[model samples]
Target: MNASFSSSSSSKGMMDHGDQPHVLAVDDNLIDRKIVEKLLKNSACKVTTAENGLRALEYLGLGDDQNNTSNVSGLKVNLIITDYCMPGMTGYELLKKIKESSVMKEVPVVIMSSENIPTRINKCLEEGAKMFMLKPIKQSDVKELRCQLMKYGS
Candidate 1:
């Protein structure tokens, strides 16, 4: 996978988040990624982005199976937010991978989708997603997420 492996421009480097939360925001859509990054940064979160699930997995030092994700290392984000309807791997699939990871199992994950299918939402929530948000993720949503994260300590 062609992982871009880059942090936000606002970041000085990998460990420069100070006391702020670091978030990994993944989306295949460029505009959506940028908007999420901007929103997270606005919420005082240091952001890193990935183009898709494979790239996000690579950035997390993970891959297709539990064994592949068993030894994750470096750039650990406090939270992960991914688009549910991505081309290669849906956010639900990505969520399973994250949940399977021993190193990343506790990291809070949020799935966003343009479609509000109850089955899909239930599946994500059942698989351990912290939240399932509708797409066009708003400033208010990010704000609420920040509050939730602070409250839950993820």
Candidate 2:
């Protein structure tokens, strides 16, 4: 795995820089989830996994409400990366749900898909996906995604 693909290291002798962004990686395939988790763990970033969109939503819902206020319950998901195709709830539908929710709407979402059909991509972008990456994932691609997220922080 590329070092750049790793999440920011906690022991790097730097400020906490706020809580390390927790990433939720949703996919039906176990191998796919493992690959993502391994890449994220290398960077020291906190990562959570869900086998489907519904499961992901359960975690997201644990956070505060969409109004941006702490929900008096728990922390919110900092980012979501979901496969575009799934058995129960598609990534598109999950994206829609995230957007509809007040607490989750602001979270950055990236759609990963083997087939980046123009219409699907456009719809996702239209619905508020920050970016999309084609399938057959690579560490370099993950590094680029980290860069994009850093931009938001700045």
Candidate 3:
């Protein structure tokens, strides 16, 4: 599936340079992606969406060309919120790939899953994911997410 991205400008008026957090949210499910987009928008973040891990890598400019490292200096994705279970590349794999990359490693990654398996959550955390969130993310979650973004910066 083709990767897609959307930026929320509704809260642009309320933000200064440091207020807007650029986020890359990945999910194969359209509804889930939209939910993330909406939630982040509500929190006044600049959000982008990707259909899967490979597409997300492409969005970050990390495709098949290993030599062409993801140049995120220009895009400045502060946080990556991705669904843990995807068709091709799971969120764990995506987190590993990002952590392995010199250009993208500094950008914090968060994994979201419907399953409440402790091992899965622990594994993601061990693999460098900042947080493992439960599926159907709520508005309350956005508050903590915003705090994380602030700590990480844009």
lDDT of 2 at 8: 31
lDDT of 3: 0.84
- Off-target runs (Cα >4 Å) in candidate 3 are 1-3, 11-18, 71-73
TM-scores of the models, in the given order? 0.87, 0.79, 0.88
Model 1 per-residue lDDT tens digits across residues 1-154:
6648557645455455547887889999999998999998888888888989988887786865545643343545889999998998988899998898788889899999989899999999999999999989999999999987887675
Which lDDT tens digits does candidate 3 get at residues 1-154? 6425554556435344355788899999999999989998899877778889988998787878777665433557889999999999999999999998888898999999999999999999999998889988999998898888778755
What order do candidates take by lDDT, descending? 3, 1, 2
After superposition, the stretches of candidate 2 with alpha carbons farther than 4 Å from their true spots are 1-19, 62-73
Residue 64 local lDDT, model 3: 86
- Please give, for residues 8-123, the per-residue lDDT of candidate 2 as tens digits: 33456554536566678888887987787777656556667788887777666633344434422254456789999999889999999889876668889999999969999999
Instruction: Write down the TM-score for model 1.
Output: 0.87
Give the Å shift of residue 153 in candidate 2: 2.3
RMSD of each: 2.8, 6.4, 2.6
Q: How accurate is candidate 2 locally (lDDT)?
A: 0.74
